[model samples]
Target: MRKTVRVAAIQAEPKWLRLSEGVEQVVELIGAAAASGARLVAFPETFLPGYPWWRWVDSNQWNVEYSTRCRENSMTRDGLEMRRITGAARDHGVHVVLGFGERQDRRIYMAQAVIDENGEIVSVRRKAGLNPIERKVFASGTPNLPAVRHGVIGRVGALSGQENQRPLLTRALRADEEQIHIAAWPGNPEGEAAGPDSAATVSRMYALEANAYVVAPCAVVGAAAWDRRGPQTGRGSGQARIYAAGGAEVVTPLAAGAEGILYADLEIGSAASDRREVELAARPRMRRGQQQAARTATPRRLGADRWAVPLMLGSGPGGLAAC
Candidate 1:
């Protein structure tokens, strides 16, 4: 049997201060994707209402309490609207991964909720860290976050905003054999100005290093979108791409920064085949052995011990320069 699944990435505008409107938009988008025969769909970061870039636009200029109220109003996890969205996913038999504002214990968080085909929430991840403007509105995630398997499809992990650029975090998560990696970009109105290259490269590198597939669904931002809307929103340019195993981009929906659904068919077996080939490679195994040998042969040194030799040797003409 062919191991295949159709996935979709949606890029669209979300109405601020109107979460009901946003959820309805998401349901509409998910319905469209299900009609296109997608089994899974993912949305951009903070898709509920909108991303909170306005927190940076001088909150002092506005009523401080009201700005806080606005953020608090947008944060939600379980409600009638959430149940409706999840029910739609269940009814359509489409697994949904969506970013939303999460309100928990008097704290607002940048969170993504993964709902399985049964309309059940499999995992909820709070953004591990906060960005510049985010610090004003949201809190941080705990340390236990990494890729977690939702159901039978694959292991899923989330990277919000610049967290995509953190190499160590990616490696740690990818090391565990994550099959589907989701990078949720906080969209701005400045087009690709907010590290679009880094966004693409992060997904590509994760796919290659993890020997798995990466689904990068970004927020759409553009000059006109910003000017017409307001400077409070940086941009709304969406770019959703899929990188196959071994760093090959299998399919990319052509419309960049536009509001639409980008679809791709994923083959999980391809990732396994790629990793088995690399694991069987002589160079890779030899590199591992070399690392082990170096670790064993190297002397155990503390701070002063490590510098002593270099410092003593540097004092002489033939000595090596201290690190």
Candidate 2:
């Protein structure tokens, strides 16, 4: 079916480690996207309470104080801040993909929450693995949490920061048939680089690989964030961008260090067209073992006992009875 959905990528800085203020800012952004007819809006990585850029800027011992503050300000799934975010989504009638520092027990994880238009929590996915500096403050996520969720805007999936560069992670999301994929990043002060490893390059490549709309919402490390952290550490320019199903650039890249919303009208019909050209999902070469296992597990015309015995004894012709 052909569907057109308006999506927004918010390229803005948080209120510099303040949870309540950050939530308020996000609420206003959500309202703005909704007002602009965006059915789905996505924010940058660890938008709530802000990304811990200080980890890279300050020394490990020096950043302890800042890290402590971040942990204190991190949000919980059912916390009041989350309720407010969901309330905003419900009130605006827009599905929201929000990235934040999620507090579970005593540990924090880089996570994103998918909120439905009805203001209900749909799925919360944690970053399957942490990047180098991130390991200092965040825990590794489970493999099962990387799948996409069905939303009003079709299958929505999200990955945080460096996870965008993980081919296997993107492949897993592709397997889930994501129609809209969110690549949430902490602004790359480095701006656009020549290599394929740059966030922008990887994001565009992911769009082409998945044949799905990729919405990259990046966070700007503005003066507020810098003021809290002391000084800028790396070259992180907030490069929020959107790409269509055919890997076509939809919205111009939001300027680095700028705070704004990048909007794109995604024509999902292009996905069908792109798939016809290269149907990665349907190609027989992909997931061969799993496919063979499924075919072998199919019930045969033989009596139930006969097939059951073969399957139980691991003596099937496919030699997958052990599976």
Candidate 3:
């Protein structure tokens, strides 16, 4: 018998208040996905009670009380609201992987959890690393990727946001030989204006490289927070998408310009076939060898002025003079 599954991407914002409020939204999404005949539903990064944009670009005028309130409102494994989310999944007989503003020992981590069909929290993955700006606010996760094999299908893991840019982390996840890959993204109102689209593109590339199915659940900025910007000042909403092995589209884009759900059916085993046909390992072999060679290469001496000439001549956005 061929193995197949249906997945849904929840491309909407968190409730932006307390855990109960967020859970209500999550339940609604999960119910919708299940009603649509989806077995697995993926949500965007920090879709639980909203993302922590205040730390990075929310500006120097951030309301400390509000940030603290949001953090306090975050969910934990032992929290009641988490149980609600898990219970909802169980009741609906769906697997859910969702992003949450996770609080541990007073530190916030951009985190996600994988709940099984039985409504059990199977695995949790924290964002292993943060970008330069994100460092100001969120905590870095431990260096590990967790995947679980349930029945005939394989459940593997990864993260979203800036972590998508990290080759090392994704490469490690790929090394684990996951069949289904998840990449969470935040929606940009400007239509892929921010790097979310690029991140999704990168996830597809990773799926192609790793010979795994990629399910990207992107988040949309809420109507009230639509115009909000980080310190860098960018627009946002979230979106959800799924990519098959070899960068194939499993479903059409669900929520393109606004809040909605996107879903697709996945044919398993396809990734494995692609894996053998392309000899996926070979793609990384040359790069790994180059790194090994670089470590053994003799050093070359150059003056500080040598670097200056290239910058002076380089043609790019921030050119020599722009620098």
What TM-scores do the predictions have?
A: 0.78, 0.84, 0.76
The stretch of ten residues in a row with the least summed lDDT in candidate 3 is: 304-313
- Residue 207 of candidate 3: its Cα lDDT? 72
Q: By TM-score, who's the top model here?
A: 2
Worst 10 residues of 1 by lDDT: 305-314
Which stretches of candidate 1 lie above 4 Å from their native place?
63-66, 194-197, 222-229, 232-236, 280-323
Q: What TM-score does model 3 achieve against the real structure? A: 0.76
RMSD from true fold, candidate 2: 7.3
Off by over 4 Å in 3: 55-58, 148-152, 189-191, 194-197, 226-238, 277-323
**What C-alpha lDDT does candidate 1 achieve relative to the native structure?**
0.68
Candidate 1 per-residue lDDT over residues 1-323, each given as its tens digit: 23787878777666654777777888998899999998888888887756765555554745355346556566567877788899999999988989888877677777888889889988887876676677677777764435656456666666666667666556656656677777776565555543436666766777777777777777665443322434644343557778886778878555655677778888764566556666667332234444444344433343321211122121233333233
